[model samples]
Target: MSLLEVRGVTKEFVTRGEGAMARKSVFTAVDKVSFEVALGETLSIVGESGSGKSTTARIAARLLDPIGGSVVFDGQDVTRARGKDLARFRNNVQVVFQDPFSSLNPRYTVERIVTAPLTYQGITPKGGRQAYAQELMERVGLNPDHCRRYPAQFSGGQAQRIGIARALAVNPKLVICDEAVSALDVSIQAQVLELLMRLQRESGFSYVFIAHDLAVVRQISQRVAVMNRGRIVELGTRDQVFGAPRDEYTKTLLAAVPRINPEWDAKRRQKEAT
Candidate 1:
């Protein structure tokens, strides 16, 4: 079953020109975009910068209210959910932002940060917040004892793990990762991606992964959506999109992805073996 569905969603921003009497114009960030994320599936939206992938992520998370279209989560319309309804929607869906440090509160200890979602939901964990937070820390491969430390004490990858732990605190049905590992080093990105896949296998929660890197999208997504100029140019399964692209934009994007020289890689591997 589809866990989250976004239909004909449109978002626009009104901007004014340089002078006081300058005219105002509307810039559409997202235009009639639609997609579905199935239960226990990873659906990635891939595009270059300013392609509205992040905007679509925010819309799916309900951080932005679209001027048009509807957002349905687990069969309930949540485009305009307010108060308790919104809170309930938040509990089921969590977001892991692009930057870990910026998303976390520096002043707060790791424990507080991880458990903040529960606190907001007014749902006290059975074993108390500290125990729950520590459990989450350990689950995400972080040291449970370091729960008392601040965000500044952790490395970039570690901090992102803390963010992941926070997202899992609510036992969300879907997790929206908005360029979640793009800021990390390539090796660290691989580690984080592995962790995410492992967690999904264990928890059976879906993922709406938004990224610009086609390589990263290939690793995690079962399905792919290519967006350009605020619209989805192509949507298909991983193999269909990567192996036989139908859209010109999609083909261009695929061609742009950097690939290592196979012959050079083989020679290096042989040398290492000797």
Candidate 2:
């Protein structure tokens, strides 16, 4: 089942000329892009910088209103949902941004940050927020005792884990990860990817993972969407897109990524199978 569907969604920005000749011109950031994310599946949108992947993420998450087309979430057309309806929609979808530190408030304790969503929705956990926050911190591999620490006290990876914990507070149906791991070290990236996959297996939530790193996408995605010039040039299963790309742009992207070691790849596949 499709948890989220974006059909022919379009978003444009008006840019003005600098200085005396200030004239407005429309720049389309997302051009009639369309795709679907299945329940409990990870659909990765991969492309170079300025390829509209991030813009598409923002539109799907309802952070940016589309100029055209519709967004259907779990059978509801929430393209222009307002008031209580918008709040309801927000409770079911959350975003984890790229910069963990910037995303988290400097002054707020980890406990407060993790439970902010619940507070916004006026829902309290069975236990108090602090206890729930500690549980969430543990689930995301953080020290539960450190819940009182501020964001600045944690390392980059630990801060990202806190962000993950925050996203899970609402038990969202869909998580839009907009370059969520791009700022971390490669080792930290792998750990976070593993954590994300494990959480998906446990919670059965879908992810719209937007990233430029093909290697990371391969590790985490079941399906792939290739975007270029504000349009999706190709979309298919992981094997179909990576093994036998038909689009010229997709092929170029694959060609640019360094080949993974076959031995390592085989071991990884075996582990997945087990």
Candidate 3:
């Protein structure tokens, strides 16, 4: 039994007609997606844009109601949960959005941003909100003194750290990172990845790491699911999928990794070594 299980989940959106000629049609966003994330393990969904990876993530996190299938989190069916149940489900399964700037409120201070989830969940820690928020800030690589500053005051990476702190405020078991570090520079991306790895180790949290970058997903995921055109075409351990992908699409993606520093000697050496 995994901590999270998505069984045959499907989502479809009816694209409305526009103007006089635009016709109405249903767009299948996710199709029969089934997978599981064990406690303390990361499951990466890798795909290009418009691949329905984000849609699957949203369905799994209960942000969107699926048209079919089930999302069982910690043995509770989240697809049908409502009211207090929905709130609790949200607390347990938090999300860190791709854009750090847009995720945090520009007007609210960092401390307030982190503490908002706690108040929403009705959790008042023994040391109170201030102490708890400070602890969370430090945990996410932010200084407690900067808690008074607004989102605009921080760098892109720092704003993301604030987002991470906010996600952890409720002691969530699962974190759905929808392209979490994709918007940052290379150096900041590495730093944020390291921080996420550390958080998972300390909190025993599972991550649904969704990204188009195979390299990024490879760095953190234990298991990988390759999605295409609203369907999961391949699913396996990281080594299995990345090293010996059975699907032609997966192999094509692997083959497309850019080689900016191409060299005959290096190419030969790499091939021979492999």
For each candidate in turn, the TM-score is 0.94, 0.99, 0.93
RMSD of 3: 4.2
Question: Which tens-of-lDDT digit does each residue in 174-198 have in candidate 1?
Answer: 9999999999999999999989999
Q: What would the per-residue lDDT of candidate 3 be over residues 1-274, giving only the tens digit for each residue? A: 7899999999999997879899899999999999999999999999999999999999998889998999999988888999999998999999999999998989898889999998898888888878888899899989988888899999999999999999999999999999999999989998999999889988899999999998788778889999999999999998899779999999999999754343853574475457
Query: Candidate 2's C-alpha lDDT?
Result: 0.96
Alpha-carbon RMSD of each model: 4.2, 0.8, 4.2
Please give the distance, in angstroms, between residue 246's alpha carbon in candidate 1 and its true position after superposition: 0.6
- Candidate 3 lDDT for residue 27: 93
- Candidate 3 lDDT for residue 225: 97
Q: Score residue 180 of candidate 2 by CA lDDT.
A: 97
Assess the local accuracy of residue 224 in candidate 2 as a C-alpha lDDT between 0 and 100: 98
| Candidate 3 Cα errors over 4 Å, as ranges | 259-274
Q: What value does the lDDT take at residue 221 in candidate 2?
A: 94
Question: Who is ahead in TM-score, 1 or 2?
Answer: 2
lDDT scores of the candidates, listed in order:
0.96, 0.96, 0.91
**Over all chains combined, what TM-score does candidate 3 have?**
0.93
